[model samples]
Target: MKKNSLILSVLLVGITACSTVTIKPEGQNKLVNKPTYQDSKPFYLWGLSGEHRVDVLKVCNKNEPLQMQSQQTFSDGVLALITLGIYAPHTVKVWCPKEES
Candidate 1:
């Protein structure tokens, strides 16, 4: 029982190692109500082995975000750590500026 519990605890830690991070344009506050800016279609699965895969999201140090809003999770890295890279999937969100009339 103790061995099983230990394994479960470790797995939990590994899975949670990767978490979502959100970034917004400078001086732009994340409002409580969703904005009408351009946003990436809801996406799922982001890893080498996942069904739907895309480049991992990253933030450039000292660089501003290209879009107005961005959010991402390094699911691939966490899955690789937990499953020896056998499984990896990432989830991301992007919001661009709205077009002016």
Candidate 2:
């Protein structure tokens, strides 16, 4: 039980520590709402190569997103751990600017 607890704690710390966030300069003061789009991006060979381009504008219907964030979630971390760093994935989230009233 103690060993399981230690592993769980370590995983939680790793997942949290790997989180990343980016806010566009133009959208700095924009009100942040729910994410407009979310997806998991796959990378191979320990993230050395893959389709890293995420079309935020296309996902946001040609409008640039106010913010974009990419991070390794618990599942992403688990998969990477299971694959021994061979296959890795990250969760991507985009927040689009609110429509003008």
Candidate 3:
């Protein structure tokens, strides 16, 4: 039991220590329907760290909604990646949603 408890504690600590991300609403906020296709949705900026991704739907001004829209949540990250011109803040990021598959 002691060995198991120690391992579990270490695992939890490692999981908690990850990068965090920030998001901003670019241009205008658009409404989107989530996993369900037939309901109201909210304008949102999805914040992801590393290579994480999510699908978002948005309706154009005079057209129906579009799906699988991609937006950049890491402007500073890209700069940091190319060189050391900019520094991306290190933060722990945890997505609250679960994967469907």
lDDT of each: 0.47, 0.77, 0.35
TM-scores vs. true structure, each candidate: 0.38, 0.69, 0.21
Candidate 1 scores a C-alpha RMSD against the true structure in Å of: 8.2
**Rank by lDDT (best first):** 2, 1, 3
Please write out the lDDT profile of model 3 over residues 7-89, one tens digit for every residue.
Answer: 97886454333343334245634434352222212222222233432333222233333332332224434434444323333
**Model 1 vs. true fold: TM:** 0.38
- Poorest 10 consecutive residues of model 1 by lDDT? 53-62
Cα shift from native, residue 75, model 1 (Å):
7.9
- How big is the RMSD of model 2? 3.7
Top candidate by lDDT: 2
Q: Lowest lDDT 10-mer window, candidate 3? A: 38-47
Model 3: clashing residue pairs?
A: 18-92, 19-91, 19-92, 19-93, 20-91, 20-92
Model 2: lDDT of residue 7: 100
List residue ranges in candidate 1 displaced over 4 A: 31-83
The clash numbers for all candidates, in the given order, read 1, 0, 6
Clashes (candidate 2): 0
